[model samples]
Target chain A: MGFRSLKTKLLLAASLLVISSGVALSLLVSDQYSKSLIDSARHQAENLALSLAIESADKVLTHDLVALQKSLDHQMKSNRSLAYLFVVRDGQVLAHTFQKNFPQELLDANTVISEDGGNEQTIVSTTGERFIDIARPIFQGKAGLLRLGISEKSLERQVDELRMKMGLITLFILLTAIAGSLFLVKRITGPLGELARSVENIKQGSWDVKIRVSGRDEVTILAKSLINMAARLKHYTQRLENQKLELERAHNQTRIFCEIVRELGTV
Target chain B: MLFSITSIKPIAIFRVSLIIITALSNIGCSDHEQSKVVNFSNTITLEKPDTKQRGDKQLRVAIGAMVSPRESISIYQELLDYLGEKLGKEIVLEQRKTYSEINELLGKSEVDFAFVCSGPYVVGKEKYGLELLAAPEVNGSHFYNAYLIVNKDSRFNTIEDLRSKTFALTDPDSNTGKLAPIGWLKKIGEKPETFFGSLIYTYSHDNSILAVSRGFVDGASVDGLIWAYFNKTNPDLTSNTRVILKSENYGTPPVVATRQMSKSMKEAIKRALLGMRDDKRGAEILDRLMINRFVPAKDDWYNSIRDVIESAGVSMEPQDGLSKSEN
Candidate 1:
């Protein structure tokens, strides 16, 4: 039973190690991937803002509102990661791709005005959608400013997918590791389990217990050594039993002689 | 002995299991704390504009629509503030869609002074006695050129290749944008309406460059200085367009004032502009605008512009009250 429980403990230890390491590895992988994806997303947003700034420079300088609106609309349609975009000059909005009224709050949401060149920031909209607001200056803020809101939803979705995949992989690894550990534990403890049972029977005075040893490992050698010890113990016990019977017979004779001597003396 | 051994083994196993459980739980807790510590809030430092009280007199300075109004404001705001500080008066910036309107404001003395294109300076000088106050010295020269450009991918090698193709021109009152191109076409014995399939007035040199770059037009004539500036500052757009021809250099645009302004005010304003490069803040502003310094303007520098307009047979007529949309 003790050996059986030892196998259980060994299996438990193996499982704990596998579970902990697997989870840690999966978490680490997913976290790194998430960070990289977000960084690339930011880079993409910055590039898009710069391109838009270049395109909008001419439109803004000429006050070509129609062409500016067309460009903004076309960009919105082409880039799905774009949530919204707009051009602002001298505190006046030139054009925007919003379907409804442009949000007044967004104007102050990002503090990087055109004079600061290009920069990005994470912002949450009134609708609770997250975005990276990127700003690029047109003509060094002389012509106007172009602002793009790159949605984080797609990045989040991608990270979630990676996490899910990592989770599944970790689970598969854990299960496989556990199965392997179980088989290993059984192989290591099989002989020891039989030895334990034989010792238990010997303790109960059953010396005829058969010990079958197998393998070239230390366990097999240990079982062979225990078999020798059990045989020697059985022989010693048989000899001791015969000596005890003789001693009893001698005691009976001594008692009878003592009684006969006492009677003769009395006569 | 067996009881003790079995008891000790189970205890040892139990202790190891407990340690693992504790270590895993610790890992989980640390992960939670680390995640909680990650902050996503973003902010920046923005300088607030000054709101100081000003004197009763305000100097209304009109900036011509050479670039966009917003751009003009940003490029000139610091310089205007510097001038206002020197003059001890508040400066109010005014903008108009056409260069002629700004000229009219200067002509009427409605504005204290104005920035006008070389062509408008020529016309305003003839029409309204608009006196030159100062001119920006770019690369140590008070002159700029007209650039005839096409999309880099286009096979057009010269102005002749643009025949029967859409062409973009800047403002009608622009020297490099209009008269120079017209003079080039005249030299080739062609007229704008007859030589090109279509023509568009982009109202600004940057816009004209963009038109050509985006393939909205087959070719365009723009200010060489603006093209060079964009090429240096923003190559993404300028790189898409190739300059095929560069016209002879003409006088750069000059800051002019009406004849009615007192001589002392003009002298003081000219001194302020000429001395800008020596001042820390003013020099920084000039550097940002790619200007070397402000120099004294001579009427002779603009004679080439007058010659181009005359030779091209282009009218110096100011389309008064015309908005950008009409162009």
Candidate 2:
């Protein structure tokens, strides 16, 4: 039972190591991927907003709203991560990509934080969609402001995909490690089991049981020690048997001698 | 007896291997993640790098507001570059919101040459002796007309049907875009101020076209050449509109030079334009612009435009006065 429990403990220990290390590796990789993906997305958002601002300056200044609308539409087609885009001049929306009514709340939702209009905010639309609203100044605020909303949904989806992939990989590694640990436990416990059986045979007064084990490890050393003890025990048992036999023979002879004397005196 | 020693070594080895594997994996992941972020942020630059040398001789050329600014860039950037390459000078493209501003740029010699509207060319010639260099030969003709258009779905089938509806004009100093349309209105004893329910100046013919196509305005008058060009090239926009009226033909807008430009430079520019069709690159640009070639400018070609403007009782000031009042 004890030996069986030893196998259980070793298996538990191996499982614990694999699990802990796998969790740690998964966390490290997932965190890094999440951070890098978010940073890249934010940078893309900012660049897109900036380029649109640059392109929209002349159109806004000239009051060419048709051209501005065309540009906004074109830009919307190229980026799927974009939620919505518009241009605001003098607190009025000049052109927007909205197919229907423009959201009035969005105008006051995010404002330019910097003098040159590089500002951003996290906003939740009425539809429950989350976005990173980026604002940029056109002609240093002389022409207008360009407000672009980049959806965070795609980024979240990407990070989730990375985590899922990482989790599967970690699980594969854990399973392989556990299988390796099982093989190692068997290799280790196999020798100890043989030694245990030999000791049981000795307890049953059978000294002919083989206790020798082969290896350059501690188990082999233990088997060697057991073998030496068994040898001494066997020698002592043989001497004791010889002594008992002599004693029995002597006693018999004495009895017989006594009988002869008695026959002449009290046989 | 040595079971403790036996179990402890394997566990220790396992633990050590686990640690080493985790460390190596973490190292690999961190390096990859770092490189990925670097690659993502590396190529984004908002400003274009200027590759032209600063010491090069520069020629300032102004393009009038014939098309919207964005379209102007796509259409003319190459032609300007070709001109710069042939003349061995850096070309600086100047643009204005109105044709009058472009003519004013030529009036002050702020620009070496300009592509001006026929109306501005006529006014600039009388006001400042603006010399004509050459005219584009579109469909073997040096003349273009004005087109009054409405949305294809509109109930208006004629210009009179658009009496009290909204209307769009291209620019104040444009012949086909404004003068010809206003002249037709005046001939029928009506004024744009009181005739249309609302009026908006789009500053470029393409914008007017877009305005009509999108139903932002019920009617718009645009340069016929620009209308035809868009009809063929951008049918998505032009297919939404139907032309209802066509005006008498006027001189096609001409390339003009400031009086301060030397005669030799004028001749050289004329030669380059006239010979452009023979050069492969120049021929491509011309093909994109839908021009067969360039021909010598005839002064009498623009007389019809002058007659129309005069008959409409429109007196244009020679300078920024007309542009400012219209604004």
Candidate 3:
């Protein structure tokens, strides 16, 4: 049964596989890298908050809240990326450094800061930008919480740069894959296209047409086999025609002989 | 050809699967290897109490102010190597941006040692149990002063004239800029935020000096060490600036270790520093740092700074008491 060519289907399948796999890999790597960056940034922010808290520990213990606030604010301002800083005492925000409002959940005295050693959550700001909130307990007892946040803009920018690079690499890989598949398909099918045209020539009475075999592949073997089959069929048909002509000649002679015998007998 | 199509499908699928598996496996292996390398390099060092007995563990050291790779590559690498050799263990330097940051690192035991300014040390001493290790002597002096400066062309001649004028102070934990000025202001019965049109924290002595010199602010309080360094190196910064007042001498910034540090290790570090000025190579390094000597110091030396910090009207609580949220 005739069907769509195998070479064409294979090429299509291969191209799809390459492109899809490239996309999948790009996505996986992007996700992993982004996660790692966010995690490292959160860790850094937590360490920073811890340091600020320790530096102001005396003030916090002595109830010198003003000194603690000034020290924290001074630190947050030094690094422009830091957005908010707050120290919670007994479930209330004892001091905050940013003008923006903070989440009340962060101020709960009973809510233990997650020191789980990694980024816990990402919050979106009113502007729709994301930030990584890093919280650390200032003192194990008495003093409540010290939460620090840094806008993810910088980290996002870094991830975006990585994504762009990976995107370029993926694009290059996809293009190369397509180009390679096309070249390979053309190489395999070029001979078959030639074979089909040759068969058409034979159908149109070009008896001298012969198929050429160049390589030791299945297509080459098939081409060679088809050429042999076509040659044998042509030879067999010519022999059959010659045998019919010979039999007809013999029959005509016999008829003449019979007619001559009948005339002689009548005389 | 039609049969070949059926056969080629399975082959192609098999080859594609193999390629994908290989690619994924390679990627996974590389990721694993990279993580291993990162973990190996990031291992913290823990120091042993006995000085003569070499500890197989590592000691983690934290430093304030992030040092650029290009600027600190040689110095820090050498410092780590030197400390590792002396302690017979690995030494890591963790850089933070502020004195408070270093103090917190010490308090959390994330770092075993640090070099901190007087203000943060005073605050940390009361809170984190910080102990002094050594003090750097610059130009044969163990003391430095705070200079209150104003534009040479400005009308202000004395600290009193700064009323209703703009003022810039370095970090709140700065002994020279914030502490001394706070003490001076309180003695004169003036409040910084209320008396001045506005107050800003520059966070660095260099920035504070530049702000006043550029006339961005009417005046600024800066560290004398930074002022002298800039005057000798880059005269342009000092050319347009004049010192309006100077604070009394105070102990210079000290090299401090955490209270968790063993007495033996602390003594070793102290001995290393005090003798640093005497060692040929150590002396050269000290010279390059513009420090004339390494002197023995105690926590008491920073009491004056503690007094200033206590009097600074600024709250140590985390709150909105400072200038309106920073831009």
The C-alpha stretches of model 3 lying farther than 4 A from their native spots are A1-267, B1-57, B65-85, B310-314, B317-321, B324-327
lDDT, model 3, position B82: 60
* Cα lDDT of model 1 by residue, B1-327, tens digit: 355443335456556656655664454345321111111233222222222233357777888887766557666788898999988777877677678778887887778898888999999999999999999999989998889999999999989999989888777788887788788988889987788887777777778887888998899888888888889877987999998999988999999998988899899899999999999988998998899999999999999988987787787543333223332
Weakest lDDT window of 10 consecutive positions for candidate 1 chain B: B32-41
Measured with C-alpha atoms, the lDDT of residue A187 in candidate 1 is 87
- Give the per-residue lDDT digits (tens) of candidate 2, residues B1-327: 555444444466467657756774676355331110111112222222123343538888888889976567677788889888888888777777888878887998878998888999998999889999999989989998999999999989877898878888787788887788788888789877678877788888888888888888899999998899888888887999999889988889999999998898889888888989999999999999999898999999999998987787775533222222122
DockQ of each: 0.14, 0.07, 0.05
The residue-by-residue lDDT of candidate 3 on B61-148, one tens digit each, is 7654322212233334555566667667677545544567678889987778887767777888888988888887887778888899
On the 0 to 100 scale, the lDDT of residue A249 in model 2 is 99
Q: Quick one: best lDDT, which candidate?
A: 2
Q: What's the lDDT of the predicted structure labeled candidate 3?
A: 0.69
- Itemize residue pairs with steric clashes in candidate 1: A142-B71
Whole-model Cα lDDT per candidate?
0.79, 0.80, 0.69
Candidate 2 chain A lowest-lDDT run of ten: A1-10
| lDDT at position A239, candidate 1 | 91
Ranking by TM-score: 1, 2, 3
